[model samples]
Target: MNAIRIDIENVTVAYHGKVALHSASLQLQAGTICGLVGMNGAGKSTLFKAIMGFVQPAGGRILINGLPIRRVQKSSLVAYVPQSEEVDWNFPVSVHDVVMMGRYGYMNLLRIPRLSDQRAVREALERVEMWQMRDRQIGELSGGQKKRTFFARALAQQGKVLLLDEPFAGVDIKTEKMMIHLLMELRQTGHTILISTHDLASITTFCDQVVLINRTILAYGNTSEVFTAENLSRTFGGSVGDFSLATSQLAPGNQEEQEWT
Candidate 1:
């Protein structure tokens, strides 16, 4: 059996008396890609924050590699890429500099990067095909380029797990494909990844597992098993009939059939 990389046990989160998540639980295996699917306010981001230790859970716990989240975080076992809207695009930093920030976790108080850090940053940028634009200001790059730069930063971190929120948003199709390919390669390299996205059509195509959440976990399992019409309807609060019709029209017939099969 594959070792579990992430384990969320009956976690709950709330703010100002409004419960964002209630008794949510999930488990992700090592070296696999899991897609988080849910509506806009279904507490997907809250769950990510809880696992990252940015938000304290009101109940239960989260474990990484059988250790507490805080312990895992201290070892730089996880990296996160937040939603694009949360970023300050106008920040005056070069692409290379932004990527180098990933190495800060290993740096001292002076924040000076070492030779090894520089080599890792260069390799990450080259892997993402962004090395040539290393000196360009972040604000001047196209949306796709900006996304790639952030991805390169995550790669430079060399974390065992990656959590990405809407990594495909606002990018062209080509860039989206590139990101997906990179994620798959990362999984093959024994890196566990969890991505929150609304692109339902790509779930079966790339993800090894799918998690459906709506204030809590509605379904979690292999992509081919949990992405059923019934589970999707529960997550989206739509009728299964409506979901099937919509999916049939929006996705390729074979893809839709695979999701249901």
Candidate 2:
């Protein structure tokens, strides 16, 4: 078993006087891939934000390898890939520029790219197969390409932990397979990966651990133990109906399947 890389201790986050995530906590170990499953507005993103220090928790604390986020950030211990919906794809930026942005944390105040930074950017883009289109406008790429571009940005950070939100949302099958393969490889290298996805099949397919959430964490543990029908039904509430425990699959209960699945 890998050592614990992420620790969340009874964290509570509120936005504009409304609590988003309350008393949420979990520990993620290095070299493991954990899935964050929840209904919409269930604080998956809030949990990610709290880990990245994007939001000040209303209560409790978070630690990376036992150090506070502030202390670990300087070491680039965590990297984030936000959901596509949160990005402005129309912004005038090239694929190479975006990937290079990840290296800014390691650069001087002027943010000029050094030889090492350039090498890191090139390697990241190449790893994601986006090097061929390094000069292309980010908005002009296909959905999968856009996703890969940002994924490359995260890779350029060379962080120990990777936080990806809805990575498979709009990607093609090929892209999905590629990402899964890459994530598995990263895990072998001792990178702890956290993914927030609506894809139920994927949770059982790849994640070693699963975190079920609905505003607060409902259950979290090894995939088979925590991803049972009972836990999923509770996490998704009235929306989740059928589950093949054998496969850890969840189907919606609504007359029509919810848009998320």
Candidate 3:
């Protein structure tokens, strides 16, 4: 069997006496992009938060590279990008400042950014093609630019795994292409990536695997085998399903309050 990069076994979560996910289990291999599809309230964002160590699981554990996730944080092995709206945009900060924050967790409390950290930030920004806007205030940039800026931040973390919530929700075609290219390059570097998205078309072409989730794991495996219309219908049986929402509506910057984690 292939080596597992992330292992979520029999994990369960709840909020205020209500359950979100029940006995969920999944194993993601290293160096592949995994797409998550599910209806709203299906525990998708909750799952990502669990992996980020933001929300504690009520049962079971999440592991990274055969080690507990709590231990994995020491290496900065996992990085997360919540939806754009989740960020407090009114906060005064520049694009460079945002990207540089990724390095803080790796640095000593009193340590200033070293030459290596600056170089890494620049390289990451360049890869996302956001270097030209490096000094620009993040609030002034367009929607796509903001996404790219955060993506560069994730790249700067140099984490072995990246978990993104709606990376392609809002953006022009050019920006979407750029994001896809960056993700592919990361895979080549042996990074494991997981994205929660509603774009079935891109999932067909860009992901190595597809995980169908709705309050529980419906299916997970090769994209070709798991993203069947039957599976989609099963995952989205009601009009309230998350699939019906346009990608435009799902953007982190555009969604309703408390939609992102």
Candidate 4:
């Protein structure tokens, strides 16, 4: 359970010659749900991109299961659920089609879905309770449904590592609960999950580990130890959302100063 699933060492990512993330490093263990918590433009997405092989780090190294991301991509060992805004809702595609796309790695040059691919897609949709809506247009679903459909796509890929970006951002409470439950189940099956989130209050609820980031990593480790008010305040540079710092760790005046929505 403690095996290192993702290894990042002294990584730095830049866009168009502008530094976005610098010297960020983290080692995520298998069978764990780690929360990547930070404020807006905190480079959480950039780090995820770097791990997914979307953007290469200008320096340092990132390894998934001791191999590079390119190899991982070829084996479908890592599945990604991007932020909602990153997708175009107007795209003409069905839920089933999107889920089947995950199996493309397993398909031949013509991209024909074999019997196993079809079965896997169906199983994935059922796992997310979206089988009934598989034929529905992807854009016609609710926010929660969209998230689930995409998550199902990831599952269909049979990846060992799952990187979900802002999964709880625009979903309802029911969707949030369902997603959390599914994630817990995956952890039990030895899947490593890294979730990038801005909702600080929810990090400790489900995460076994927490990473506090503001461009570079501020603090990271066991959630109970690293998700402290002091570290969080430092990460956010102030209070954010409906969060109140605990008095036992910080002075009352500091606590008051750190509490805000």
Candidate 5:
């Protein structure tokens, strides 16, 4: 049987008395691509944060590799690619520099990059096909290239698990395909991947498993079974009759908003 990479049992999170996630439990198995799906205010990112130890839950437990998340900095076991919009695109840094930062977790307080660290960074860049553009200023790269650079940064961590938030949002088709291929390769190599996205088409076809979140976990399992019209309607506050119509109303500037899924 595949080992469970992450397990959340009866977890709940709240902010200023407003509940974000309610008694949510989930299990992410090794070597699988699981997608978190739901509309805004669905509490997907909050669930990720809880698993990453960024926020402590008010109840229940989160475990990573059979260890309590609070005892270990879960960041070392799982890599995170936060939403692109969460990053400052104007930051004055090179692609290589950003990728090398992933080594900080292994470094001491002095945090000097060693030869092995540089090699890992280089290999990570190569893995993402961004080695040639390593010296370019981060701000000068295209949106897709920038996303791949961060992805390389996460790869440099060499963790057993990966988590990405809206990775395919606002990218060219070629870059999207490249990212998907890389994710598939990661899965083949025994790494567990959990991605949160609202792209129902990709969820329907690309993902091995689907999880619907809306202030709670509505459904989770194989995509064919969990992404039903009934479940989508329950989690999305409406039917899947016209996902694009509802999504269009919130697309233009909604990227910058603090939404769940």
Candidate 6:
């Protein structure tokens, strides 16, 4: 088996007095893409935040390559791309500058980007096909372009583990396909990726493993084993029959007409 790159062991998270996650545990092997699936407010983002060290767990711990998250972060072994909505588009930074921020982890205290850093930034941008627009302001680009810029930043970070939250949300089909291809390429190069997404149909298509969660982990394992109707229903809280109806209702044809809860 490949080495474990990310290990979340019985982690619990809370907000104020309410428990958001209850002893959730999952392990991600290196060179694989794992999909984090759940309905809205299912603690998917919370789990990602915990792994990224943005939230202190109430219990348990997260390990990156057998080391603690903080140590892994300091070594630039992990990179995160938050949901687009969480980002401030009016930050007044160029695309190249935003991508260059990934190199800050490797820079000195003065934060001066070296020639190697510039080369890395350039290569990342080119890989995502955003090099031509590197000079453009972030706010000026379309939704897909913004996503590409962030993905490029993650690539430039040169991290072995990548965490993304709702990266495919609100993206066009072409853009979604492009991102999926990029992720596959990254996986081939031995990068471990965990992407939180609501597109259940894409799980089988893109992920080698799936972790289903609702307040706590409902299921976690190979995609074929965990993404079944039964597991999805347990995660989403409905009968298999209801799940089928709900899934059909949320299909691409009806997605624009109805809002997903």
Pairs that clash in candidate 3 = 85-252, 85-253
Go through the candidates in order and give the C-alpha RMSD of each one to the true structure.
6.4, 4.5, 3.1, 6.4, 2.5, 4.2
For all predicted structures, in order, the TM-scores are 0.90, 0.90, 0.91, 0.89, 0.91, 0.90
For candidate 6, the per-residue lDDT at 61 reads 94
What's the lDDT for all of these models?
0.84, 0.85, 0.82, 0.83, 0.82, 0.84
Candidate 5: tens digits of C-alpha lDDT, residues 188-218: 8888899987667666666889988889999
Q: What is the lDDT of residue 73 in candidate 5?
A: 65
Error of 2 at 119 (Å): 1.7
RMSD of 4: 6.4
Model 4 segments more than 4 A misplaced: 1-4, 239-261
The weakest ten consecutive residues by lDDT in model 2 span 252-261
- Model 2 misplaced regions, further than 4 Å: 1-4, 243-261
Displacement of the residue 154 alpha carbon in candidate 1, Å: 0.5
Query: Can you tell me which runs of candidate 5 are displaced by over 4 Å?
Result: 1-4, 242-250, 253-261
Clashing pairs counted in every model? 0, 0, 2, 1, 0, 0
What global local distance difference test value does model 6 have?
0.84
Query: Per-residue CA lDDT of candidate 4, range 86-117, in tens?
Result: 68887999999999999999999999999999
Write candidate 2's Cα lDDT for 165-184 as tens digits: 88887788888888998999
Consecutive 10-residue window with the lowest summed lDDT within model 6:
252-261
Provide the lDDT at 219 for model 5. 93
lDDT of 1 by residue, 1-261 (tens): 134488899999987677888999888778899999877777878888888988788999998878888776765678898776667889889999999999999899887999999999999999889999999999889888888999999999988889998787678888899999999998888888999877787778999999999899999999999989889888878775654454454332222212211
lDDT of 5: 0.82
